[model samples]
Target: MRLITQSLLVLALGVGLARADGETAGEFDYYVLSLSWSPNWCIREGDARDADQCDARHDFGWILHGLWPQYDRGWPSFCPTRHRNPSRSDTRAMADIMGSSGLAWHQWQKHGRCSGLSSDAYFALSREAYATVTHPDAFRRLKQPIRLPASVVEEAFLAANPNLSAGQITITCKDGGIQEARICLTRSLEFRDCGADVQRDCNLNRATMDVIR
Candidate 1:
């Protein structure tokens, strides 16, 4: 039910982004934020009973808080208390996952060509960091993932979000030494939308996964 609801929200958002016409940037951000953050784990853990129970059982130092009367050692509950995520802060964990950033941000500055997609200003990052933020067409550099200061990216999205219509986007480069970035999703982008086979790669909840597709 949670996943289904988030999926519908994304469809509404994409539709809203498309046909809403003539809205302000901030308005767009506000709208998008709802979709971006919908499946966010940290944001919702406070309210979900299953989540709370799981936290108490596994995450909270393997301590059972006794709140969950039906707790079973092996049986899977709706919340699935079997596994617990160790770290919650997104950016830090992703950097660790990527295995030491093969591409240097500074290297991109010296040898990386614009190839007509990325802006020159995006080079604020070092070669290693720049290399980490990659999209499919990394060599052809056509479908490049954006890079900019995180704050810059956030503000730009926030600013232009309200006024956007279909096919419009606000781009920013990563700043603050791009070890990694976990953009605060105001709305949800379901993992399924990212990729059904690789939803775990995205580390998103089912709620987030629903809308991504």
Candidate 2:
């Protein structure tokens, strides 16, 4: 009886972990649109990997990282979905905004699957969400790298996009460089306040913002 009870307890724990790791598709409350600073990404990881995004030819600045479905609390990923996966061509078309077809495919498998939309629909919505916000031109016009507070990045975004508020967007830092700007939006693609879990703002006083390649 003791051994049987221990086995049941272990099974229950395993089930709990699975639930925490993933959730049902189309059940999220909102979306988080992440825009990555390409130069900073190259400086931190892409340069080492010789990623094509780091190449000077692309001249990418803020690129769409992913459009993630979010819950009010935590988040879901890798959720099982009935929709078909995107073909190579479908993902390749997103490369102009996403930086890479590989990243587009990965996003479809992870966050896109959880969106409850088909691959094409998910990509469309992601594009629409990205276009809804105006990227600050100042960042793109920078001739040299500068160190500035992460909040200033957020302020620039807010200034460029008056609809977005401080609570609706967050700036993140990685490896001491300005990383990504995440904005929360409703499922209908309207700006909305981010959930507490998604409001982690980087407090760096002088985070490096790399210039466009």
TM-score of each: 0.16, 0.91
lDDT of 1 by residue, 2-88 (tens): 999999999999998766442221111111111111112222442363433223222211110011011111111122112222223
Mind giving the per-residue lDDT tens digits that candidate 2 earns over 93-124?
99999889999999999999999999999999
Best by TM-score: 2
What candidate 2 gets wrong by more than 4 Å, as runs, is 1-21
Give Cα-based local distance difference scores for all models.
Answer: 0.24, 0.95
Model 1 segments more than 4 A misplaced: 1-111, 116-122, 125-160, 169-213
TM-score of 2: 0.91
